[model samples]
Every structure is written in C-alpha cells, then in structure tokens.
Target: MLDYLFAALLGVIEGITEWLPISSTGHLILADEFIHMSTSDAFKEMFDVVIQFGAILAVVVIFWSKLWPFRINRDACGSGVSGLVDRYCRKDVWDMWFHVLVAIVPSAVIGLPLDDWMTEHLHNPPVVSAMLILYGVFFLLMESTVGKRRPQVRRIGQINYRMALFIGLFQFLALVPGTSRSGATILGAMLIGCSRTVAAEFTFFLAVPTMAGASLVKVVKFLADGGGFSGSEVGILLTGCAVAFAVSMLCIRFLMNYVKKHNFKVFGWYRIGLGALVLAYFYLLKPAL
Candidate 1:
C-alpha cells in the first residue's frame, strides 16, 4: 500500500516536471532521496526511465492529428496496395518525422556509448545540482539577449533540416543528469531563431521517439539482467504510469498555452533555487546531520 502511494507521488512529479523546462529525471532522483520504495535498486533505476512511457503516450494522444502521417481517401488511385498507399500517405508529416530522425542522430550516437558510464558516475546529487544551476543560467542569458530579438523561425513548418540537426546537437548536451532534454533542445532552437511556440512544439514532438527508445532500452536492460517484476512491482509500475499519463495531459496543455505569451524566466529562477537547495541538503545539511 505504501509503495503504491509513493509511486503515485512520483508519478505526479514526473508528469509535472517532464513537460516543463524543469528536469523530470533530476526531480525523480531527488525525490528518491526521501521517498524510498521497497523495490530493489535495479528496479528503481529502470522504473525512472520506464515511467516516462506514460508521459510519452500523453504527447501522442494530444498530438495525434499532427503526428499521424496518414489520411483516409475514398477515391482510389489503383485497385490494391498502391491505392492504399496513395490514400494514406501524408508527405508533410513524413518529412517532419525525417527531420526528427536526423535530430536524434547526434544524441543516439553519443548517448548510447556513454549511457552506462553516465548512469554510474554522473547520476548523483552533485552532478545534478551543478547541471541544474548551469542550465538555469543558460536559460536566463538566452532570454535576456536572444529573447529580445524577433525570431526567424516562427512556425513548426519553417524548421528545416539544418535547424533540426542544430537542435539535435544541443540535445546531446542533455545526456548529463539534470540537463533536461526538452530544455536543451528548446533553448538551442530559440538560440537559432525559433520562436518560443515553435521551439516548444518541436521539443514536444522530438520527445516522442527519444523517450520511447530510452524506455525500451531501459526495460530491455533490466530484463537482460534477470530483473523480473513481482506482482506488487507490476502494480506499482502501472499505478505510476497511469497517474503520469493523466497528469501529463494537463501539464502539456498548460505548457502549450503558457508559452504563447510568456518566456521561461520563471522556470530558470526555479531551477537555480532548487539546485541550491539540493546542494545545501546533500553537502552541508545532510553531512552535519
């Protein structure tokens, strides 16, 4: 019962933080310091990544029309497979997906090789705190300078292959704990002349594949290591995912609306404050205790 309750709480955290410029993984890591579950370390590690599957599903649901690259057509071009293909193929959507694929390459190439090393070494309070503060400053600086200019890329459709690849390269920075993948890509996009709305939308779209692939990898690695879920673990995982899905729906909607008129300055300040608190707790307060 207690485990389920904790899972729900973590789910709430994930749903809220995942969409925001705030780091969901960083928040989860910090939350774990206090909300220790009955699960093993391996299960907990896997749970953090897998729980994001729910959040990904939320994006898919909200952007179904935009993400789905197909359409129904009553008029036929041919009799069989060719007709079906002609009816369903959406060239624009397919092109957007190709851009997304190109953007993910830099991260996949770099992240895959360093996943284990980063998990073992960088997944800790000190590293998370440092990144939280560092990126918070980056956000502030970008907004003060670049935020003042008229953006060159104001629509999602305007984002071309070169821009997507540039954003993806920045995403590689997010491999470090607390860097926040969305934050990095959105910031990078903004720096490269994308409007706030366009940057946020593309970031949300980019997350679908990136996070789904990550969750799959985590699950595979867990099973490969002989980590099987007991009944309770399964229940806990589902509970967390369901809650995350529900909360993510609300959060994503809120973010899309919020970015239209506002900048990310508030989130930057919040990150800096949270990073300070984490550092003080782990290095100063906790050690004294």
Candidate 2:
C-alpha cells in the first residue's frame, strides 16, 4: 500500500514535469532520494523509464486526430486504388510522422551508445542539479534573445526537414540526466524561429517515438541483466502508469493552453530554484547533518 502511494506520487511528478520545460527524469531521481520504495535498484530504474509509457498514452489520446493517419471515406471508395489512397491516407499526418522519425535519429544514434555510461555515472543528484540550473539559464537567455523576435515557423507543419534535424541534434543533449528532452528540443526549435506553440507541439510529437524507444531499451537491458518483477512490483508499476496517464491528460491540456499566452521564462525560474534546492539538500544540508 505504501509502495503504491509512492508510485502515485511519482506518477504525478512524471505527468507534470514530462511535458513542461522542467525535467521529468530529474524530478523522479530527486524523488527517489527521499521516497524509497521496497524494490530492487534494477526495478526502480526500469520503473522510472517505463512509467513514461503511461504519459505517452496521454499524448496519443489527446492528439489522436492529428497522430492517426487514416480515415474511411466512402465517397472516394468508388474511385478505386488511387482514390483509396486519397480517402484512407492522411498525407499531412504522414508527413508529420516522417518529420518525427527524422527528429529522433540523432538521439537514437548518440543516446544508445552512452546510455549505460550515463546511467552508471551521471544519474546522480549533482549532475541532475547542474543540468537543471544550466538549462534554466539557457531558457532565460533564449527567451530574451531569439524568443523576442518574430518566429519563422509558426506552425508544426511549417517546421522543415532542416529544422527537424536541428531539433533532433538538440535532443541528443538531453542524454544528460537533468536536461529535459522536451526542453532541449523546444529550446532549439524556438531558437531557430519556431513559435512557442509549434515548438511545444513538435516536442510532444517527438516524445512519442523517442520515449517509446528508450523504454524498450531499458526493459531489454533490465531483462538481460537478470532483473525480474515480482507480483507486488507489477502492481506498483501498473499503479504508477495508470495515475501518470490520468494526470498527463490534464497536464498536456494545461500546457497547450498555457504556452499560447505565456513565455517559458517562468518555468526557467522554477528550474533554477528547484535545482538550487536539490544541490543544497544533497551537498549542503544533508552533508552537514
């Protein structure tokens, strides 16, 4: 029961932080420091990544119309195969998907090679705190500079192949623990002239494949290393994922509405403050005690 409660709390954290410019993995890591679950280190690690699957489901739910590329058109059915293609296939959505695929390449290429090293060494409070503060400053500076200019890509469709690849390159930077995946790509997109809404939307779309691939990798590695979940562990995992899916629905909606009228400066300040708190707790306050 207590473990389930902890899982729910972490779920809430993941759902909220995953979409925001603030880092979800950073929050989960910090949360783990205090909210120790009665599970092995391996399960805990796998739990953190797989719980994101719930959040991914939320994106699919909210954007199903945009993400799904097929529909039935009876009118075009009579015209044969060419009409079938036109009726059932959404060219725009497919194009968007292709762009998403391109955007994930850089992260896949770089992140795969360094995943183990990073998890072993960099998945610590100090690294997480440093990245939180570093990207926080980047957000502040980015907003003051290119963020003030008129955006060249005001819509997700306006994001060209070059822009998608550039954003994917930035996604590679998120291999660092505290660098939010959404934050890196969104910041990169906005820096290159995408509007805030476009950057946020593209970031959400990009997350579907990026996170799914990452979760699959973690699951495979966990199994390869002889990790197995018990019955209770499965329950805890399900609880976390269910709660994350529910909360993510609300968070994604809120963020979409929030970004239209607001800049990311507030999240920037929040990250810096939270990063300082983590550093103080781990390095200063805890050490003194």
Candidate 3:
C-alpha cells in the first residue's frame, strides 16, 4: 500500500510537470529527496527515466490526428477515431516528421557523449537551481522583447528546416537539468517567429519521439546491465506509469487551452521562485548529504 501510494504521488508530479515547460526531471529529483521510493537506488534512477514513457504515450494519444501520417481517404472520411484512412503516402505529414527528426539530432549527438559526465558532476540541486533561474530569466527577456512583435510564422506547418534545426540546437541546452526541454524549444521557436500556440504545439509534437526514444534506450541499457527487479518493484513502476498517463492527458489539454489565452510569464516567475527555494533549502536549511 505504501509503495503504491508513493508511486501515485510520483506519478502526479510527473503528470503535472511533464508538459508544462517546468522541468519535470528537476522537479522529480527534488521530490525524491523527500519521498524516497521503497526500491533500490538503481531502480529509483531507472524509474524516474522510464516513467516518462507514460507521459509520452499521453501525447501520442491526445494528438493522434495531428501526429498521424495519413490523410483520410475521401471515401473514409467520417467521425471518431477514423481508422479507415490510408496509413501511408502522407507527403505533408512525412515532411513534418522530417523536420522533427532534424530537430532531435543536435541533442542526440551532444547528449550521448555527455551523459556520464553530466551524471557525475551536474546532477545536484545547486546546478539545477542555477539552470532554473537562468532559464527563467531567458523566458522573461524573450517575452518582453520578441513576444511583443508579431511572429513571422504563426503555425507549425510554416516552420522550415532551418528553424527546426535551430530549435534542436536550443533543445541541446536542455541537456542540463532544470533547463526544461519544452521551455528551451518554445523559447527558441518564439524567437524564430513561431506564435505561442505554434511553439507549444511543435514542442508537444517534438516530444513524442525524443522522450519515447530516450525512455526506450534507458530500459534497454538497464536490461543489458543484468539489472533485475522484484515483483513488488515492478508493481511500483507500473503504478507510477499508469497514473502518470492519466494525469498527463489532463495536463496536455489544460496547457493547450492555457497557451491559447496567455503568455508564459507566469511560468517564468514560478521557476525563479522555485529555484530560489531549492537553493535556499540546500544551502541554508539542510545539511549536505
């Protein structure tokens, strides 16, 4: 019961933070300091990474129409969950996927090399705090300047290869903890002339592949290392994933509606305050581990 409860709590955190441009990994790391799972350190580490699979699935299901590569056959056009459509030969959708592929390359190239190095040195509260504050400032600055001007590209389809590559370059910054992946891409996209909705939607689309592939790699590596788990541990992992999926669907919908009406400044202020709190808790209130 305790393990299931903890799993559900972690899932709630993941669901709320996952799509909010608010650094879900950073939030989870901080939460783990308080809510230790009844599992091995190895399992806990893998749990945090793999739990993202559930969140990614939310994006896949919620945005299936936009993400599906097929246009419905004229004969098959109907209603809910149109499955009778052509599943292939979607040139426009394929082009969008190509752009998404390009946008993930820089992070894949850079992150693969630095993974161990970052894990060794930068996976601490101090580093996370600094990044949170840094990106908070970045968002506020961008909104004050670039956001006031009318964007050149107001829709995701208007994004070109060069812009996608630039967004990918920005995503490379998210290799650092606390530098939220969606935050980086959204800010990059907005600066490059994507409207608020366009930036957020593109980030959502971009996450489907980037995070799913990442979760798969982590699981594969864990298995390759001869890692094994108890039945109870497996239950905890499943509980977390299932809860996260349910919560993420709600969050993704809320964010989509919220962005259509407001800017991201509230998130910026929240990051700044949270970063300060994390720094203070570690440096002044708590003793070092």
Candidate 4:
C-alpha cells in the first residue's frame, strides 16, 4: 500500500516537472531519497522508465492536430481526376517533421549505451545537487545574454535541420542526472536564435519521440531481463500513469502562455534555491550517513 501510494506521488511529480525547464529526474532522485522508497534493482529501474510514458502521452494528446494534421488521401479520389485531390498538406508541417527527426537522432545514438550505467551506479544525491546548481547557473547566464528574443523563428516549422541537429547535440548534456532534457534543449535552441516560445514548444514536441523511444527501450530491456510485475504492481503503474497524464495536461496549457509574457529567469532562481536547499539538507541538517 505504501509503495503504491508513493508511486502515485512520484508519477504526479514527474508529469508536472517533466515538461518544465526544471529537472524531473533530479526531483525524482530527491524524492526517493527523502521518502526511502527502496526497491529491487529491476523494479526501481522499471519504475523510472515506465513513469515517463505518462508524461509522453500528455504531449501526444495535447498536440495531436499539429503533429498529425488531417490530410486527405489524394489517391482515394476516383472521379476521373487527372491529379491527386487537394488535401490539408502544408509544406511547412512536413519540414518540421523532418527537423524533429534530425533533432532526435543524436541523443538516441549517444544516450542508449550510457543510460544503464548511469542509472545503476551514478544516480547519487550529490551528483543531482551539483547538476541542479550548474544548470541553474547556465540558465541564469542564458537568460541574461539572450535577452533579445528573435521573431524570425517563431514556430517549429521555421526550424531548419541544422538547428535541430544543434539542439540534439545539446540534449546529450541532459544525460547527466540533474541537467534537464527540456532545459538543455531550450538553451540550445535559444543559442541558435530561436525565440523563447519557439524553444519551449519545440522542447515539448521533441519530447514525444525522444522520451517515448527511451521509455519503450527500457521496458523491453527490463522484460528481457526476466523481471516480473505482479497484478497489484500493475495497478500501481496504471495509477501513476493516469495521474501524470492529468497533471501534465494542466502544466502544458499554463507554460505555453506563461513563457510568452515572461522569461525563464524565474525558473533559474528556483533551481538555484532548490539546489542549495538540497545541499544543506543532506550535508548540514541531517546527521552523517
């Protein structure tokens, strides 16, 4: 009962924090530490990967129209038409699709090999603290230097393959525990001249493929390793997924509107403060471990 309850709590946290520039993995690690939710290695690993699916589904549900526009099949036109019937084909949407592919390739290539080793051995509280602080500093600097938001690249459609590739390279940094995938990717886009709103939205879209693929890969590996989930365990899993999806829907709606009027400096400050607090709690407040 306790484990199930904790899993639900963690899932809600993941959904709410995952899309934000804040580091969801970092928060998860911290929550586990504070709550003492210990588990077998296989189950622990599986929980981390599976919970992410909830967040990924939220993006798919929210952006279905943009991702898969209603395009009528021209070949279905049989009324003696010389050419294919007109459909909702936008050259820009196709181009954006191509760019998203370009952006996903780099992280997929680099992250697959390192994921197990990092999650198994390198997931530590001190590392999370350092990452939170370091990325917090980067966010602060990025917001100050790139204060002049550009208007040319307003939407994902405007992003070129080269920019996508650049963002992919930056995303590899997020393989570190504390550096957030969204945070790293957004900074990459902003550095390459994408506006804040564009960078944030692209991060949300890129996550659909990137996170889904990663989660699926992990689940496959866990099952291949002969790990079994009980009936009650499956119930807990579903509960977490549903909670995460519900929270993420609300978060996406608010963040899209919020960034239009403000910058990420507020998040940066929050990260710094949270990081420092984590350090103090573990090092000064608590007794030696």
Candidate 5:
C-alpha cells in the first residue's frame, strides 16, 4: 500500500516534468532520493524508463486526429494511387510522419551503443544536475537572442524534412540525463525558425514514436536480464502508469495552451533552480540531513 502511494506520487512527477521541458529524469531521480520506495535499484531504473509509456500514450490519445495516419477526408478528383493515397492519408500528414522517422534515426543510431555505457556510468544525481543547468542556460540564452520574433514557420505544415532533421539532431543531445528531449527539440526548432507553439506541437508528435520505442526497448532488456516483479511491484508499476497517463493528459493540455501566449524561459529558470537544489541536497545538506 505504501508502495502504491509512492508510485502514484512518482507518476504525477513523471507526467508533469515529462513534457514540460524540465527533464523528467532529473525530477524523478531527485524525487527518488527523498521518497525511498522499497524497490531494488535495478527495478527503480527500469521503472523510470518504462513508465514513460504512459506519458507518451497521453500524447497519442490527445493528438489522435493528427497522428492517426489513416484518417483522411473524402475527395474524389484523381483516379489512381494518388487518389487512394489522398483518400487514405493526407499527403502532408504522411510527409510529417516520414520526417519524424527521419528525425528519430540519428538518436536511434547513436543511442543504441551509448545506452549501456551511460546506464553504467552516468546515471546519477550529479550528472542529472549538470545537464539540467546546462540546458536551462541554453533556454535562457536562446530566448534572450530570439525574443519571440515573428517566426518563419508558424505552422507544423511549414516545417520541411530538412528542418525536422535539424530538430532531431538537437534531440540527440537529450541522451544526457536531464537534457529533456522536448526541450532539445523545441530549442532546435526555434533555432531553425519554428514558432513556439509549432515547435512544441512537433515535439509532441516526435515524442510518440521516440518514447514508445524507448520504453519497449527498456522492457525487453529488463526481461532479458531475468528481472521479475512480485505482486506488489506489478501493482505499483500499474498504478504509476495509470496515474501518469491521467496527469499527462492535463499537463499536455496546459502546455499547449500556455505556449500560445508564453515561452519556456519560465521552465528554464525552474530547471536551474531545481538543479541547484539537487546539488545542494547532495553536497551541502547530505552530511547534516
């Protein structure tokens, strides 16, 4: 029962930080430091990665109309494969998914080799702290330079594959804990000339595949390592997933609406503050506490 409660708390943390450009990994790590769930270290690590399935599913459910790929308006003009394509999938939507596929390739290629190494070496509070501060600085610097000027790509439709690939390259930076995948992609889109909302929406679309695949891989590895869950552990995981999905729905809606009128510098500042706090907890307060 205590584990179930802790899992719910973690789920709320995951859902809120997961999409807010504040690194979910950083917050989750920090939370675990204090919350102290009675799970093995290995289970906790795998739990953090696999629970992202819930958050990404929120994105999929919210954006189903845009992401369904099979949904199309009926229009009869052409009389061939083009017509069938139009009837089944809108050309631009197909193109958007194609671009998303292209964008994920860089991370997929680079992350595969480094994932094991990073899990072995860099998964720690200090590393997460450094990345949080680093990306926070990036957001502040970017906002200062760009200053919400009229954007070249105001709509997702305006983003070409070239731009998508550029954003994906930026996303590769998120392999570092606390870099925030959405944060990197949003910054990249802005750098390459996308408006705030457009950048964010594209990031949402990008997360579906990226996170889903990542979660699946984590599950596979955990199983291969002969990781087994007791009834309580399984219950905890399910509770976390369900709570994460619910919280993510609200978080996504709030962020989408918030960006229409504001930028992410607030989240940037929040990350910096959280990073500093994490450092303080580990260094200044650990001895006393």
Candidate 6:
C-alpha cells in the first residue's frame, strides 16, 4: 500500500545519494519527514537502518562483475597463491580489491563504536543540516584552495596501498553524522594528488565493501533483537533494494562521466541549500516535533 510506495521512494533517494559525495544519511533523515510514518523514536531508528540495506544491495549488484575478477584466458600463470590467483584472475580486479580492503580498515576500526553512539543520540534533522552546511563549506574551500590538478588516474589499480590507507583514515571522520564518508575520502584522494574524477571513481568502488559491511551489521543487530519480520515487511525491503540497485547503476554511470568534465562545486551549493532548508524547518518554521 502506501507504505510500500514510500519504501520505494526512500530507496531511490538512498541509492542515488549513497554513492555520491552528498550525504545519503542526511537525505534519508529529511525524506522520512515526508512519508507520514510514525515518529516514534524506535520506529524511526529501525526505518533509518533498514532502508540503508537497500542502498547497500545496490552496490553489491551494480559492481558484482568487477568485485571478483576472473580471467577466462586460461594460459595466464604464475607460481604460488599470487601465481594461482594471477592464473585465474584479472590483475586489475585483484589490485582494486586490495586497495579497497586497505581503505576499509581505518573506518572499520573507528566506526564500530562511533556508529553506535551516533545511532543512539544523533539521528536528527538539526545535526544533518549542520553537517551538510559545514561539509559544503569544506568542499568549496577544497576546490578553490587546491588549484593544482592532474589527469585522472586510469583505473583503481593506479592507486597505491599507502593512498588507500590514507583514504581509509580520512573515512574515519565520516563516523560523525555530518561529514560524509564518500566526501571525506574523495577530498583525501584529491589532497593526496588524485584528479577529481579519479578520486570520485575510487570512492565509488570502495563503497561496495564499506557500506555493505555497515548494512549487514545493522541487519544482524535487528535480527538479534528478536523482532518479527513479516512477509509484507520483507516485500517492502526487497522492493526498496531493487529500486535502489537499479537507480544507483544509472547514477554511477552518469556520475563517472560527469566528474570527468566538471567539478564538485555544484554539489557544494546543493548541500548548502538543503542544509539551510532543514535549519529553517527545524528552527524558523516547524513547531517542536
């Protein structure tokens, strides 16, 4: 019914913003206001975590072909584990996976505790709005101050483990509700000398693991709580997941090409505008919730 419809709408929002440097979590918080769902605090928490699974699924489905690389060429050979891996796998995919793993560790270590705290007390429009505006300002300053630019790194393979770890460390900041993991990582890559397009693409690739792990953790927590998940609920989740997956594929394709020719300044303006609106709604417009 209407719940299913709302689920789909949220899925679309999650998919598109999840991978973008824009804050998907921030959008989800704001979008929930439009769904007419109960505002009970527990329900709101469940809704936020559950819908993210949809976006996480999008990453898995859209990037499945590249996540695990296989070489059908048969003749490619080496020696030990690396040799056997080389014999059966394309070097490019293997290299990309390594960098992703490297980039994942920092956030994983720092986020485990921080995420719990944020979920407990920080899931509100005011926080999201402030983060969106503050990060937007950072984005604007980054582009203007860092004038040296270079050709895009051709593929994820071009990134080194050192850079990957640095990106992962930068990702820790995203544990704060307002600073985006993608935004922080992208900015870190650029600061370390990656072209904007290269940084964006690498951020997209890394999201598959980072977001998936976070989503799975949430799912496990929900299940462990012993709450019943009805057939209708499952259906709603699947619909959301499907919609997010499909839309995200398109978004990634479009963003990949878009960043090659443009800068992220436009998104900065967008974040600022959205942040201002949230602030207005919470402060100047709406009565206390």
Better of 1 and 5 by lDDT: 1
Prediction 3 global C-alpha lDDT: 0.88
Could you tell which candidate, 2 or 5, scores higher by lDDT? 2
Residue-level lDDT of model 2, residues 134-234, one tens digit each, is: 99999999999988899999878888788899999999999898999999999999988999999999999999999999999999999999998889999
Query: How much lDDT does candidate 6 score?
Result: 0.76
Task: Enumerate clash totals for all models, in the order shown.
Answer: 0, 0, 0, 0, 0, 0
Each candidate structure's TM-score, on Cα atoms with residue i matched to residue i, is: 0.95, 0.95, 0.94, 0.90, 0.92, 0.87
lDDT of 5 by residue, 1-289 (tens): 7878989999999999888999887788778777888898778888888788889889989988788777543355444343333445566788889989988988999987799898778779999999999999999998888745778998888888889889999888888888898899999999988988989999999998898888888888888998888898888898999999999999999999999888889988988998899899899999687
lDDT of 1 by residue, 1-289 (tens): 9999999999999999999988998999899899999899999999988889899999999999899898755356545553443455887888889999999999899888899999999999999999899999999999999999999998788889999999999888988889898899999999999999889889999999999999999999999999998999999999999999999999999999998999999989999999999999998999998
Cα lDDT of model 4 by residue, 1-289, tens digit: 8877888898888987898888998998888776645456677767876888898888888987677645655477666455453566766667777888899887788778888888877688788888888888888998888756555677777788899999999888888887899999999999988888889888988898888888888789888998878887787778788888889999988898998898888888888898999899899877655
Which residue pairs does candidate 4 place in steric collision? none
Decoy 4 TM-score against native: 0.90
Question: By summed lDDT, which 10 consecutive residues of candidate 4 come out lowest?
Answer: 78-87
> Which parts of model 2 are misplaced by more than 4 Å?
74-87
Candidate 1: give the clashing pairs: none
User: Candidate 6 lDDT, tens digit per residue, 64-112?
Assistant: 7767687554234533344333445677888888998999998888778
Worst 10 residues of 1 by lDDT: 77-86
User: Per-residue CA lDDT of candidate 3, range 1-289, in tens?
Assistant: 7878999899999988888988988898899789976687778878888888889889999988788887777666565464466765777678889999999999899886787687678778998899889999988999899989988997678998999999999988887889898999999999999998999889989988898878877777788888887899889999999999999999999999998889899999999999999998998889754
Candidate 1 stretches greater than 4 Å from native: 74-86
Candidate 6: the clashing residue pairs are none
